[model samples]
Target chain A: MSLDKATVAHVAKLARIRVEESDLEPMAAELNNIMTWIEQLNEVDTDGVQPMTSVVESVLRQRSDDITDGGYADKVTQNAPASEASYFVVPKVVE
Target chain B: MNDFASRIIQGATGDWEMVIGLEVHAQVISNAKLFSGAATAFGAEPNSQVSLVDAAMPGMLPVINEKCVEQAVRTGLGLKARINTFSVFDRKNYFYPDLPQGYQISQYLQPVVGEGIITIDLPDGESREIGITRLHLEQDAGKSLHDQDPNSTYIDLNRSGVALMEIVSEPDMRSPEEAGAYLRKLRTILRYLGTCDGNMEEGSMRADVNVSVRRPGEEFGTRCEIKNVNSIRFVQQAIVYEAQRQVDILEEGGSIDQETRLFDANTGVTRSMRSKEEAHDYRYFPDPDLLPLTFTQEWVDSLMDTLPELPDAKKQRFIDDLGLPAYDAGVLVAEKETADFYEQVAEGRDAKIAANWVMGEFFSALNASSGDITQPPVSAGNLGGLIDLITDGTISGRIAKQVFEAMVESGKDAGTIVEEKGLKQVSDTGAIEAQVDEILAANGDKVEEYRGGKDKLFGFFVGQVMKATQGKANPKVVNEILRKKLDG
Candidate 1:
């Protein structure tokens, strides 16, 4: 239920978040408090309960295999910060 | 065991064995994306196929596609795998530029298909069964073109949110050849099911190979994953290089660092991509947007009924019902179209002869002209007619070859070719006896040697008789007359 500074830093790195080193202890403490509050539910004996994926009592809905939305490239990339020739451009990433 | 014995690598200290497993990602053949209504066609204008849900815009929800689910179920049945009526989708968290959603919805705890087995036919006429671990559905990320720009990468979201089946195999394969056979058989099955195209070159299907080396009969070694091998040849090559690389490390007393690697086709080598320190920690959780997928056993059975006769069953029937040799059966049933053609040719004819013609001259002609079996130059019915000529004593097997060549050249039926060319077999005993007497008169000294116990000379007399008759004499009648004339 506790979050250490290193764990917080690792989580931040995984999320690609720029967390200041100076705020690590405070953030870890705050996250620890939240986790401790959430851990209180572990005390309840709910072995037979099923895990819930949705709040609504409905099965997953399926769509037919039809192309109903496309062909508007301009609208598709309208929100891109940088685009060229109908492509979203970002920093080069090679693995 | 003998075939696999050659696959073992001899290190400086001992013989090393390779343990291989494959993870194949096959794109579902569907018109639209997995969770969106956008088109899934390839080679479209960049971003033209992207929908709001695929782009992972805020508040956009995902809806499953019925066709993709049905395809996954059908594929499971084809593999003879167990279908889980209840399965859930989980979000695999990661950070990547191409993955705009920052998480890929995959099946983790409960996969759609459970364990199964696939029997792969080897080149040495032996087969081994490879185990299937699981098959689950996931979303494909958008393609990123890194070489497009100097300092930036161009991203096309057209492939985003496409449905892909991640088929994982057990670490049962001990050789690169086994790995190759396994991929080919799996591709054949996938194509038969019509679930996935299994076109590796077009990027519709690709495999991730895991290779490790260990001393024979020891615990499994640390393995490395080679990512996105696009072809079966490259997959085999990657396993060989990676297995040797691991062997060299172990022989030198250095342990392998379990991580992901990349196979370079040009170099035919695998290089480390990421180390264990930066390994992925995919925290998976059930997605709240979509509920668990549930279906009845009756629905699964209905899908099963829709599956075509897979390669294994067809191969077995060819051997059991048609009395074909295992090798011929394997070759005929490798492709669905070829198998269908064989069946058509073998319909009321000699199965073995039909197989020989289909696998021999028929296949050669098709290959020489680069023709597909689906649209062959010679139809199956015409080939059957050609076989009929030899079966009913219309023409000798030797003359039948000439007639077959003529049929191929002129697109004429076997009967027309036989009639026009006068290539009918002379099965009359009188005509064969006259040719045999002429040969006996000409090769008088050889005939004496044949009566003096040089029995091999009898073949020469038969050859001479066949030559005199222009290869039109029925071989059985020629043999009978030659035996009587020479022996008397």
Candidate 2:
């Protein structure tokens, strides 16, 4: 799909990213180049060629459909940036 | 056949056909992160496992892990996909705080593996083949902490630079079920190969759902990509919402636009996140810093030699060799650990009976304890011992349940538990006959009813006999002696 500069700017806003005015031109040019490359795929005849899904051709591997831990509170909280007792601490949202 | 394609086309007024493909990112199960030697254990202290490399310290260069590559190849072979003799990694330019590296090391044009197929089993015992577009090796981005603070964001680098196999599927699925089945089948294969842990909850495996809608007979519709749908339930919900969104657009005489979208589980809707970029968006030139990866055929062959019996083959063995039902076989071979445990318990025993016990009482015990078969309190050997006791008439099934519980609690052999508890089945005919005589003598009217050809009273007699034995009577022997005494 072709991406325009206006669309890119809007996307950047949605992503909460700040793109400089100077960088916009370069970004647009790069995005256009990518679209052109992907356009090359249109030249190929994929009519009968099945799309590949996996890298291997093996049977499925499964584990018994059993439930396990949503437990391990300490391990879950071990890496929290801020913690109070066993729970993770975050900034209060409400007044 | 009115398959998913036909139904989708029909729903679109026979105008166009919807095409779909998937890109699944499965985290590699390794002792440490791909680049750093920091422990990759799940549920760890958030940033405790982070190293300087993961934190993207200045002047730190990413070093490739050989084990990750081998696992990627093993996965590629499992998929019947081509292992690119040479592949290169490129930096995917993206700005997210979670990505400490600024740019993610991912494959753009040259991925480690290419072109594979996954055959998914449909509900009606039919199978459909989905094509694998590519499987590339990439590093994971860290996480952004948005809920922690309103004005500030935090970064957890524990996940950064962790290895991932970005498996892209062809837009071959037409319905939500097929998409789900495809993901499940792929996950099953990866788990069996021991390449990926396939833990969606741990963020070990995730799906980026690509959905588009078109008229029944028309070309592919504009596709929208949904990012980071971590569970199968969410994957299905995401696709349904995305497809409806596309259909709504077409119905309003507007064209569907190709873009990246986010699924809000709370609202059950997809909102546009970004315009889907073509390949050039990331400027996907091969990385100048890293060399191309190459592997020898001998190494690939050696890995293949060590591959355990996968789900399909194992399922077939259970059916042909063990005479188990197809459903039972399918369930047993879904996971390697479960299959191995079953084999140990089923050896030298009736396969059907073994299956019943494993799937029934054993599964319930595990469930009750909130454990997996891997951590079962009762070992396969102990379970087998319990099954043997039942088959040899040492204990009736009713008595065996009691013994099995004791075994699970104490980790004792079945024989020792039975002996200690005095829980042996009463199979002696003389003893059983004496008990039956006492019961019949006490209940004269019921005994007269049995002699008078009221056959219904026979069950009452049997119940009396079992009660006399304290529920320890061998059911078969009790029935046999009760019939003889009544008939005489």
Candidate 3:
């Protein structure tokens, strides 16, 4: 449940967050406290209970397999930080 | 087990056994995306097929597509797998430009379909059963276009959230041929079920090939996955090259680094894409937006009942019941449309004759042109009629072949062609006798020589009679009358 400074730094890097070196110790301490408290909730002996990940208790309703919604590229790309030729543009990723 | 392990590449260290499995991603045949109402048709404009939920807009929820789930179940039944009554969907968290959602909705721990078996028809007329580990339902990612611009990468979300059935197989293959046969057989079954079109070139169907090498009876070596091999040929090449690479490494006292690799089709070699440490650690959890899928056994049974005869059963029937060669039966049942056409032609007729004509002249004619069985120029009824012309006394076998060529050219029925061309077999004894008299009168020397015990000259007289009748004379009657005329 506890996180060291290096582990906190790794978590920040994986989440794409820029955690400054000066703030790493405090961030690690805060994360450790939260993780400890969450671990307490796992100690309860609720062996027979089903795991519920969502508040909704019903199966998903299916929409009919039709092509009714489309051709709204302008509206879809309107909120993008940058767009070119009716497409969202992001930094190039090479693999 | 008469296994066709023909292509086992021998290494200096030992005879390395090739272990191969496939994870085939078949795009479901539903009209809409798996979780969104977006159109799932291929070849649409780049983003014109995207929905709000498909584009991963915040606060948007996903509604499962019922048709997709049904397709997955049907495919599972075709694979002879267990259709679990209750299964859950999960989120596989990853980041890529093509993926609009940072996490893809996939099944991890609980797939919709469990272990299935696919029967593979090997090269040596033997068959093997490959184990299917599981078949799960998932959403596809969008396509990223790198070549569209030199300075930037373009994203198309058309394929995002599209329904896909990820079928995973156990590592049961020992050679490249087995793996190739496995894909072909699986594709045939999927095409038969109408769940996937099984077109690898169109990206609708693709495979991730897993390859490992080992000594006989030894624990399995490390396996590296070659991702997105689009064709069966490439899959075989990848397995061969990857197995050899691992064997060389081990033979040289080098350990294999577990990794993900990519097959270079042009070079016929596999190169490491990424090592194991760099692999994406997909954090999988039950999808919060959807509920666990549940259905009764009745639903699965109903699907099974409606299922068409798969390739193996249909092929077996063609062999045992129809008495066809293993090769012809296989070629006929490779595609559903071809099998249906064969059935229509063979119905109530001599199936062996039907099989011969269908596989011989009919297949070659179709192959000569680039036409599919769906739109064959010669209909099944016409083909059956052609066979009937030979079966009955309407036309000789040679004359039927001539009529068949004419049918292909004109797209006319066999009977119509026979009547129009006046090519009916002259089975009338009087007509053949008259022709025989004329040929004897002209070939007086040959007739005399034939009576003088030159038995070969009798064949010359029959040839002349056929020439005079334009090859329409009944062969049996010609033989009988010519013998009587010559012997008398």
Candidate 4:
């Protein structure tokens, strides 16, 4: 897929990111090149191949479903930029 | 046609049918989070149960909790679904304050469990099947407590990364009552399997209700999803409101928009949260940090063997083997503890009588006193003993109610309470004869009036005799003796 300045700005807005007007063209052009490079794999001709989802051949490792850790609320929230009443506080989010 | 399926709205032009489906998120019954070893207990202080992995610290990888997978499989089997031997996890990218990570790890495109069937028992002695779309395992986001401050919101990540079984149902329900029944039946099965607590008020179980309205036999209308309805009653209300809203829009020649809505518990209305076009595009990709989950057929079978007799099977047994009426069987099997209590009381006794006492007196007593079955003030054995008293004519049915109240008050067995209080039925003819003679002598005017054809005085005579004996008189014996004396 190709990208344009307006589409790039729209995507950024949907992601809740503010994009500068001067940077949209460069970002869109860069994104288009990446997309085109990735699209080159369409030329390969294998029809019956299964998609490889992971590199590891092992089964998913599991742990017993027991409460082996926690009770460190102080440590967990210590790095929050703003915290109060044992909770991370942020500017009001409406819904 | 079923009556519940017939409940419809007479719109500006004609009748409309509501199509409803539910996506229920039931928290898995585990002590730890899904991918971390942190405690998953509810109502803890904010962030108290967070581990580094749940907090999304740098360089921390996820390890699946094996018991959670077992729970999901058992749930699938209980719902009569197909369990996949191979499944993968995909990350759904989004941004929210409660979500520590920018993306949520969910199973998309290929969920672990496939199609299943949930048979909902309609009130008209008919059944309807709501198809199960799919079930997937996903981690929960934390809570955003907005009421904590006016200018800021507080976040509690204690629930973050907790394992949940997201069960999606097909759009098969036609009315609000059907949706309610569907939720109740689903919850009952999950509770019986010990996979979920099914406590909606505690937020352990929640539903996302999708509602759409259309003219009968027309194409499906645009649907909206109501998010996080915590109670079954609220789910019912939300469906009704959202469906009516859609119908109103359609009747005005306005098209419905697919969107997300919120059910207002206070106003009993639904308000738009966002339109579908403005919704976040969740770019999903398989997480490279974890491997694909694979389990053998043997493992799934073993879990199947562990499932207790589910609600439908138990209900059938109660009806076929125990001869309980369909409605009574349904009521008794709504909860496992209640079903077990009914079985214990019904063992070798008159099953119909057992059903009556459990569904009638016992249930009302529990409701009146705000009691539960786990530690019932009146034990099942004692309840059975009370029923035995009435069955064997040791006490009349009227007298047994008083004895039952005494048992609840004193926690005494039926026989103990009868003997201690001298409340046994006075079946001895000689004893009843004496009380009958005294009542005949004292109520001379009434006896004359009765002989003068005041036929209703017979009940008065019986009442007096019963009152003299403290309601312990065998009703049949009292009627016979009083009839012989009063008629004379």
DockQ for the candidates, in order: 0.76, 0.05, 0.59, 0.74
Candidate 1 — which pairs collide? none
Q: In model 4, which runs have C-alpha deviations exceeding 4 angstroms?
A: A14-18, B1-6, B275-277, B437-460, B480-488
**Which scores greater on lDDT, model 2 or model 4?**
4
Tell me how much of the true interface, by contacts, candidate 4 captures: 0.88
Clashes found in each candidate (C-alpha, N, C closer than 3 A): 0, 34, 0, 0
Model 1 spans with C-alpha error above 4 angstroms: B1-7, B275-279
What lDDT tens digits, residue by residue, belong to model 2 across residues B181-283?
8888899999999989999998899999998987665677788888899988888778776786787778778987778888888987888775344322654
Chain A, candidate 3, TM-score of 0.85
Off by over 4 Å in 2: A1-95, B1-20, B35-39, B43-59, B122-125, B215-218, B275-280, B441-458
What is the lDDT for B223 in model 1?
94
lDDT per residue (tens digit) for residues B111-173 in model 4 = 899999999998878888999999999999999998989999999999999999999999999
Q: lDDT by residue for model 1 over B207-257, one digit each (tens)? A: 999999888899999999999999988888888888889988888889999
Report the TM-score of the second chain of model 1 against its true counterpart: 0.94
Worst 10 residues of 3 chain A by lDDT: A53-62
Better candidate by lDDT, 1 or 3 = 1
Q: What is the interface RMSD of each candidate, in Å?
A: 1.4, 12.0, 2.0, 1.5
Q: What is the lDDT of residue A40 in candidate 1?
A: 93
Highest-TM-score candidate: 1
Candidate 3, which segments miss by more than 4 Å at Cα?
A1-6, B1-7, B275-279, B433-465, B482-488
Q: Against the true structure, candidate 2 has what lDDT?
A: 0.78
